[model samples]
Target chain A: MSTPRPLTLIVNGEPRALQVEPRTTLLDALRERLDLTGTKKGCDHGQCGACTLHVDGERVLACLTLAQQAEGRRITTIEGLAGPDGTLHAVQKAFLAEDAFQCGYCTPGQIMSAVACIREGHAGSAAEIREFMAGNLCRCGAYPHIVAAVQRAARALEQETLA
Target chain B: MMDFSYARPADLAAAGAALAAGGMALGGGTGLLDLAKLGVARPVAVVDLTRLPGLDAIQVSETEARIGALVKMSRLAAHPAMRAALPAVGQALLASASPQIRNMATIGGNLLQRTRCAYFRDAAVGSCNRRNPGSGCAAVGGVTRGHALLGVSPHCIATHPGDLAVALVAFDAVVETWSPNGQRLLSVHDFFLLPGATPGQEFALAPGEIVTGLRIPLAPVARQARYVKLRDRASYEFAAASLAAGMSLGVDGRIADLRLALGGVATIPWRARSVEAALIGEHPTPAAIAAAAALAMREAEPQPDNRHKLALVPALIERTLTDMVGEPA
Candidate 1:
């Protein structure tokens, strides 16, 4: 194994400097090092989207990203989705309003991806939302409600933009 | 996963040097990292190529387009110029993987992606010739529902698992690479190798060579292309049988030019040159398209469990070609 390297990541709007082994993934860094445990590890492979997050505003699988590869990039986890003043993000509110989760294992990843789906303009229709958010899988079978939440959030965001 | 050092080279020359020293070049790390976790790939060091300049540009012109190898799959799928010029490229990219993966995977890595054969992925299978040449093939008699049909041998039958390469091959795209010997261009058809006696030798890329870019010529057929993918699920799954068909019709409604390729059914992206010849200058009727589609898979050799692909491939081609002749939706 190689020696631990010093790396800095701008995680959740904060610059965090840490020493990590070369094999450590960005998912592991967020969960173990920074204690941001909201990012779940479903498969630890790229197939599952339980570790979805935004790296430079692009929704990517964190487990497939090496910690070293994320140096000097903006990282946003599920915990960082809320406003600094303690208000929930519009997408999060829609998820709660629609009761879009069961067993809640895939909630964080679902909400994160839903937020990105709307921002990426894939929320034009319910079918389109489902197609775009196909990466995040919920074993508990809350897909219908999740799609509704995404649609609702998309409308809310558009209204906010118009205002 | 193995713990290996990572180096981010500042330039292509340094990247070539790093790769020459027995290191694997890392693109988006979507494929490499997944293989590492599965214990399939364990390199000594990973030379990061994203920092290198001139390998991430996507240039589009009226006649052609040059897409850098490091360009992400998501960007390529959503580029306005690329979507307008070569719609099949976007269609193929969108049909592949999922949104999150497309955001992370690069074009170079996608072309070089390993097969998703169940036997090859499971190292414990101990019979995958692609993973261990001459070890024998378990999929030949085992679970072959997802194996190859167009190109197969006794040694290996793993299907190539990329969608973009399928579309690129139909257009005669050229892959540009850099090495100590300078730069070289390889046609997409000759770039991927059949899993013959040497299933381990998957690509023509040398150990120290790095894919720099891809050049695709724009033809009238390119604008009228469509990709049809049939899979177990509607989204986020590998194709059971996919077809990419493109052609331009003359004012009289006859085929002026055509290109066709198949995915999820071959050891490499299978270009149907025979089918192209059958369609050119002919009016595309249902019967005519069906006859041509049958000729495309005349040489297909399928395993017991995957013989259905022989039927599925032609049906998909006929449908895609028929749709291509109709009004654009």
Candidate 2:
């Protein structure tokens, strides 16, 4: 057997070094190794976005990314999206207000993606948000509420900036 | 999962060199990693290209656009230049996979991604020609609702699963590849070959070759281009049938030039040269477009479950052309 490779990843703004197999996905490293269970794994394949997270401020499928590839990159999970005082991100608040989930298995990934969607300027219109969020499948069929949450979050973020 | 050694190269040349050392190249790891986890692509080594530099830019010039291999599909679609120069390509990218997959999936990976054939995905299923050549295509007589209707061979009938590649073929884009020998450029049409006889060989990339960038030529016709995809669902599903149509009309509503390519109906991106040849210098009327659309699908030989695709092709082409013609001046 070959020796395990050492990789250093910045998860949730914290630097973590670990020895991992070459085949370990970022999702596996996060959930199994680092104990960040917020990023859920639905389809290990790219078809589902339950393992969504932010790699350097952009939403990426953690399940498809190799842990070694994320070395030195800033990774933001759902647990890290809150402020220093643990105040909810505007998107998180909107999701709660709109009840954008049912079983909530996909909510973490959805919320992570929703925050990124707004930050990336994809919350312009409901259609745009729907298009951008198409990757995160809600098996519970909560699409309308999810879209509404994104729209509300966009408005809230805009108002906060004005205030 | 099978054990494999992995190496992350700092640049394209190093990545190519690692690939030359008898390892499979990894990009985005969406497709390849999944296959590896399922013990499908059991290579001895893996060359990681995620950290490779200079392969992540979307450069737009006045006359052309160069998209790096590592450029993510979401970024490519959202890029202002791509939206302006080749809206059809952007639309196709936007229509592919989902936003999360799009963000992680690179343009090169999207082109090189394997088919979504159920038999191919499940190695224990009836032998798949694409996974193992000459093993016989289960799709030929098996469930083939999604099989190819054109440019297929007895060996394989797997339809290419890329929407963006189909549109690229319609735009006559060139694929720029780098190898140990030197750099070579190939038209997208030639880059992806028909599954004739050799179904195992998909892309035309040689051993140790890396697709560095895609060079899209400057064409005014692109302004009037459209990519229309019909799928089982409105989003996040493979194309049931798709049309990428590029047309340039003269001032008097006559067709100066026309380029049409079909997806989800062929082993490769089916460039409708037959349709283009018939429509040039002809009047840009619905009747002429219909005639050309019919000509485009004339040679379509659909299998038992895929015959509906033949009917869907004409309507998709007509609608795509109509939309392109109706866009704002």
Top candidate when judged by TM-score against the true structure: 1
Segments in model 2 whose C-alpha atoms lie over 4 Å from true places: none
The stretch of ten residues in a row with the least summed lDDT in candidate 2 chain B is B320-329
lDDT of 2 at A115: 88
What shift in Å separates residue A6 of candidate 2 from its native position after superposition? 1.6
Per-residue lDDT over A1-61 for candidate 2, one digit per residue giving the tens place of the 0 to 100 score: 5578888999888899989988788999999999999999998876678999999898899
Of the true interface contacts, each candidate retains a share of: 0.88, 0.77
Query: Best candidate, lDDT-wise?
Result: 1
The residue-by-residue lDDT of candidate 1 on A1-163, one tens digit each, is 7999999999999999999998899999989999999999999988879999999998999999999999999999998999999899999999999999999888998988888899999999988998999999999999999999998899999999999
CAPRI verdict (incorrect, acceptable, medium, high) for model 2: medium
Chain B TM-score of candidate 1 stands at 0.97
Q: How close is candidate 2 at the interface, in terms of C-alpha RMSD after superposing the true interface residues?
A: 1.4
TM for candidate 1 is 0.98
Q: What is the C-alpha lDDT of each candidate?
A: 0.89, 0.86
Q: Once model 2 is optimally superposed onto the true structure by TM-score, how far is the C-alpha of residue B54 displaced, in angstroms?
A: 2.0
